[model samples]
Target: MSGPWTEWDHLLKVDPDKTLVDGETFEDVCQTGTDAIAVGGTTGMTEEKMATVVEACGKYDVDLYIEPSHSNAVVHDDSLDGYLIPIVFNAGDISWVTGAHKEWARLDDDIDWARTFTEGYIVLNPDSSVAEYTQADCDLDAEEVAAYAEVAEQMFGQDIVYIEYSGMLGDPEKVAAAQNELDDATLFYGGGIHDYDSAHQMAQDADVVVVGDLVHDEGVDAVRRTVEGAKDA
Candidate 1:
């Protein structure tokens, strides 16, 4: 049950393709008490962009990770604590599930297996860019969601099961459903966690609450509040 993410209660996801709130630097964001910083995006991701964010956050002491969307965007850096490669469980297109991972293995000869792990992702937001890009099936009921979580843990042997509602708030009932099925795989909940209450609500069931887009929109102050919320839960 213990790994790089075992003690993590909050994760601040930084999109390489987007800018942070005006005047707020990576230093500010990194010091927000988030357990880790996840660098990635659904689109416009390249090695240069990934490196930019990684380097900025590298100066800090917090754990840093790359959630590579594709092989082209993967950056090898000593600053990264690990790679949280996402395998979309409900992707309508098979590429999100296996094709992208295969391509990364083929293209990158220097993969650090010791510092890499897979995240079983169930993208459940119909309007999110990740959903559209991966062609994810987002109309599942609570039972269906739990089944995916079960398969991700039991069949795939994933260390983490992520319930992602990319841009909007997700149903707490569905998140709890996924939690009920997992025995050891850490449950991560993300999307629409813009404030303290939303973060607390999701953190109650999810082992780690991931916050993205909030820092870009509201700055580090808002991010600090969510960190408190997640820890408080």
Candidate 2:
């Protein structure tokens, strides 16, 4: 409650288009009526790219956060509000459990951990590249997902519980399932949310609807459309 999460609403996730310039820039992205700006990508995140994006975002008045792909990727600067580290507890491996965190602690800067964002991090049974590459054993039914949510809240003491469908489109049922099963945890949904209607459906139970790829591919107009759709929903 005290750290960087003083307020919350729809978030706009930044995409890494190094060769391109967002006609909007930080001012433009923030102007799209988003509550906050999330800066990070699962892959191809260079320090230079991260710095440029964060610096650009600083010109805007909205609160800013970074989703570090890993410990090395986190570039701590005075402008950042805090970090949103996704803990994939259901990965069925301890590597993402404590091993990954231990590595991050060695960073030169101290982590301004606002809230431990615990995610169900479910990889669809058919399999996505993220699950396969991370070696996540994500063959879970709704029951298992709910159980994971409970543990993530009680055992891990997480303030935010995210139902993530990484690298592919999200399933509304899956996200709603996890949201229903948890208690006192801020619910979040992300992945493949392209339009306002889809964003609305995803936002039904989610406290935050993250739109990343759309911003990367479509541009500011897309961000405005999506944010308007989400707010009106």
Candidate 3:
């Protein structure tokens, strides 16, 4: 509750691939009224592509962060606020939990721990790129998801606990269960949030609601509405 991410109650995650595909620029999306902007994606990720997006977002005064899916996709830029790396808690592959972390630390010497934040993710999309890459365990019940959240906060000392439903809409009861289990750690819920109502509902359940794909598919106007809903929630 007291760190670089403490103020981010509503975030808009923009995937560079999708943004460019939708024919919208990052400068326009950065002004969508979100508390922060997270740049990253599960597929087709590269340092060059990330740098392009970061450079555009740097023009804005908003907090800009990178959520790198792999070590190869990480970008080194002073303009970026920091990194938001994910540790998939229910990943079927152990590599997603810790193996990649060790590799990144070994490869990159510029990782400032003070500016870094780790998000413990319970990915719940069976068909998402993240789910496919991490081999996520998406069959857990609400109670079980809550247990993972507790472990992330107490054992791992995670700064953020993310319930990621990805391509599918999330279950509010599951989000609430994780929120109830966590004490000080920030809870972030992402997935299927394309409009005001869904974003508002998720905002009520978690400390932060992350909207992705919506901005690419529906444009910044739709993303702005979600930002309003999240803040007003």
In terms of lDDT, the best-performing candidate is: 1
Tens-place lDDT per residue, model 1, 81-155, is 989999999999999998999999999999999999999999999999999999999999999999999999999
145 Cα displacement, candidate 3 (Å)? 0.3
lDDT for each residue of candidate 2 in 95-190, tens digit (9 for 90 to 100): 666677778877635666543343445455446545655566677777777777788777777777766675566666667788887777777677
Candidate 1 is scored at a TM of: 0.99
Off by over 4 Å in 3: 20-23
Worst 10 residues of 3 by lDDT: 16-25
**What RMSD, rounded to one decimal, does every model reach?**
0.8, 2.6, 1.3
Local distance difference test, each candidate: 0.95, 0.70, 0.89
Model 3 lDDT tens row, 86-138? 99999999999999999999999888887788899999878898998999888
- Worst 10-residue lDDT window for candidate 2 reads 1-10
Ranking by lDDT: 1, 3, 2
Among these predictions, the greatest TM-score belongs to: 1
lDDT of the structure predicted as candidate 3? 0.89
How do the predictions measure up, each by TM-score? Answer: 0.99, 0.87, 0.96
